[model samples]
Target: MEPTRLVYEAWKRTEKIIQNTKDAKGNEIVREVEFYDPYDVKHMEKIDSRCFLCGETIQEGIATKHVFSDVFTDWNRSRYPIGTHVCPACSFTILTNPKNRTSLRNFSFVAEEKLHLPNRVEMRQFLVEPPEPPFLIVLAVSQKKHLAFKGTVSYNREIYTVMLEETEVIINRKEFTRLLAIVERFLFAFTKTEVQTGQYNQQRVLKFGIDRWEWFEEQVKPYRGTELLNVVMFVAQKVEREEDVLCFMGLGQKTKTPPQPHLSFMPSIEAETNDVDQADQICGDKLNDSQKQVQSEQIQLELF
Candidate 1:
């Protein structure tokens, strides 16, 4: 992570903090900073995303309520800085508690048939600090119309704001890598197939089974086609530290094993095997002589 010219506040429970440091010119400078402000929030965008705090499915036009990050404290206060979304029910809970991070609201990922939802990113007693043992929180983007399920941070949070428009954010390479890892883990299931045959059969029998995730090499990874990856990868690269997230989407630890080699069978397809072959034979039996002769020539040509 490359260092940037910026200031960060170590969240203090009571007293404000100050530190003296020398700048590029070796001139002593004093800076005042405060930790992430308490949950002053705004409305959510009506569509394109599910609230990270609440398991609310959002849609457009029908619901005029804009889904927004619960941040802005005062309605008149113009500094409605970017934040993660929370639905009305969850929003009321937070308004009553102001600082509550944990929710009874259930979360899920479309990544796997049976998914393990990660733990919520706990609000520290002070400010944002390095996790004791690194953990993750997963967020899902709802699929509607022709859209497919996607993993993301914030839908309303504009990417270019942190990039082109200067903000208090300073990003480093380590943070970028961490975000990419989140995307790869949440979206990994798209690469798998139920019908295990040829190359696909080999891919499903991953050594780690459900516990492990496929790695993303950037150039090679494709989820919901490459278009989705490009948006996510760009968001991972561009967003500020606030967007750096991981989901402990797993309910609890299970005895993870390297799944046995060979392939797991698809019962639906395997069960119909005899029926398909029998139908084909029946069709072939009914062919007239001229039709049979034509079929034979087509088969010969295919072989040739």
Candidate 2:
């Protein structure tokens, strides 16, 4: 499916749910949609980092006045910090519309992010614990409903899921393209086949819930736990384009000297000498979604 089409379908689904009034008090519940836009960017202490949204240097003045990032999460959470740097434009588009955001970290924030609808995994009963120490607690806010519409604030913690096999092959630029194409093709075919059978639903499939993840692994049990399945989950929705399959590792510069990697799951990140809004402890404090652009320096995941 085209990326735009898949994104639209997801939005349409959310729209239907939103049409009904909240607190109607029935079995049918519309899961709240969450986003990560912060207060006015002007008051924010700007970090000397690149904009995670467009990969451009965040110039002084208006270009990056609204920039923000989340705090470094517990080292036990994961090897990398839990956030990235986002530009103002991206902050507006992503925060303003539910149709323009995705749970996965692919695609540019300048563009509308694909929506990641809630599902059974999102239900409290099926939440899965991360395998390693650094508990990857992805924080989100329900700021989208406030865009052009009145709504209340809600906090949500989502798991950062890894769901593919990264070849880690040393390939030239041309080979890299071919590799992505092949990986995408196989996944598309597999998903199509599953959908044709009674095994998958387009809307609910591809979620990274613990039970779902284990079930997905069961299908290819032989490959489970092997080096073949090292890829991260791109989104909670079905496959659409190459962006969902590939990872944008890093897009910002260090505001301070890089901190050495810690042996404990909880690693220490050097904060900018002038400003630091987060801590290296439980990773409680947060900025916004755009600040999560710190993948390369904090995480060494084998990506596409």
Candidate 3:
């Protein structure tokens, strides 16, 4: 097996190094993403030191940014003009230092137009808990609704949720109106079928809620006395589909078990069981057919 694997690796490396690695657009790749800086004197001294965060040190050279194409095309070595440079110290700092890790994670701001909607609106949605430290906090303002919402996303969970700060919207009348108009138009124009079916809807589910403006205060109090006039948005969920089965170890993976048959026993009759607890509460609220249709349409529009 080792011999066969070695032969395959040699053959593959020969082909890749010859055809793809040659004349790679190292510059273009460099242009697309930002690189970490190691030029600082303090960081430079830590060059041979162990990674501050992970504690592992690469022997080849100073640790630098690791870049890879998402689609896995030919390796464009030259594209990364500004390569990541890390010393043992930085590597360790990155993995172990909570403050440093948080700062690094917070730097992942979405570029403008990355979340553009059809009519030139840009979305500022985030995770309830981002998957990286220095959890993400976003403030969004919509011209149509003249609304601003603030929310935080964590960095550790697969599930992403949006949060609306209970803060007030401070935009002038026109912008606020425009923002609301966009939201309402989306609600009215979207069709129910769109929400009920398709991969896109499955990927981005909308979650909405309204509470006293105090909610915003509690959420943002840590950043005390910050301007509240600029934030306004609602919470939503970001969903992803996995192609393969996922395993959760130990915590007892959920498995289906057939229901056990009940054995009949002598009935216990305590004189009608105190009137069968007539006061037990049961929720019966539901949208009627037309209302359901409209709600579905609203979901579709928001999704779009």
Find the candidate with the highest TM-score and give its number. 2
Off by over 4 Å in 3: 1-49, 60-304
Looking at model 1, which ten-residue stretch has the lowest summed lDDT?
Answer: 1-10
Tens digits of lDDT, candidate 3, 1-304: 1111222222233322111111254432111222233333243432344332223443422434331214423223222323344333232212222233222121213211121111111222222112243233333322211111122323322322222232322222222222222223222322323322211242223321122112222222232222221222232111111110011000111222121111112122222322112211110013445433322322221110
Q: Model 1 — TM-score against the truth? A: 0.16
Per-residue alpha-carbon lDDT of candidate 2 for residues 1-304, written as tens digits (9 for 90 to 100)? 2222233333434433221123556455565444433334453446555544344454321232233224312223211232245444334433333355532232111111224333322311111212232212121223222121011111211222221221221112121221222233235335533422335554544443444433333333332233222221221123343232222101111223232121112212221312122221111122223323221111222111
Give the worst 10-residue stretch by lDDT in candidate 2. Answer: 145-154
Each prediction's TM-score versus the true structure: 0.16, 0.24, 0.20
Query: Which of the two, 1 or 2, has more lDDT?
Result: 2
lDDT of 1 by residue, 1-304 (tens): 0000011011222254343445799797764323223233443335554434333443421121232225522333111223234434334312222343322112211111111222211111001222221111123222111111111211111111012111122222222222333343333333322211113333544632533333222212323233323323333311122111111112001213222111121122112234223422433344566543322222211010
Per-residue lDDT, model 3, residue 57, is 47
Kindly indicate the candidate among 1 and 2 with the higher TM-score.
2
- Each candidate's lDDT (Cα)? 0.26, 0.28, 0.24
Q: Model 1, residue 247: displacement in angstroms?
A: 33
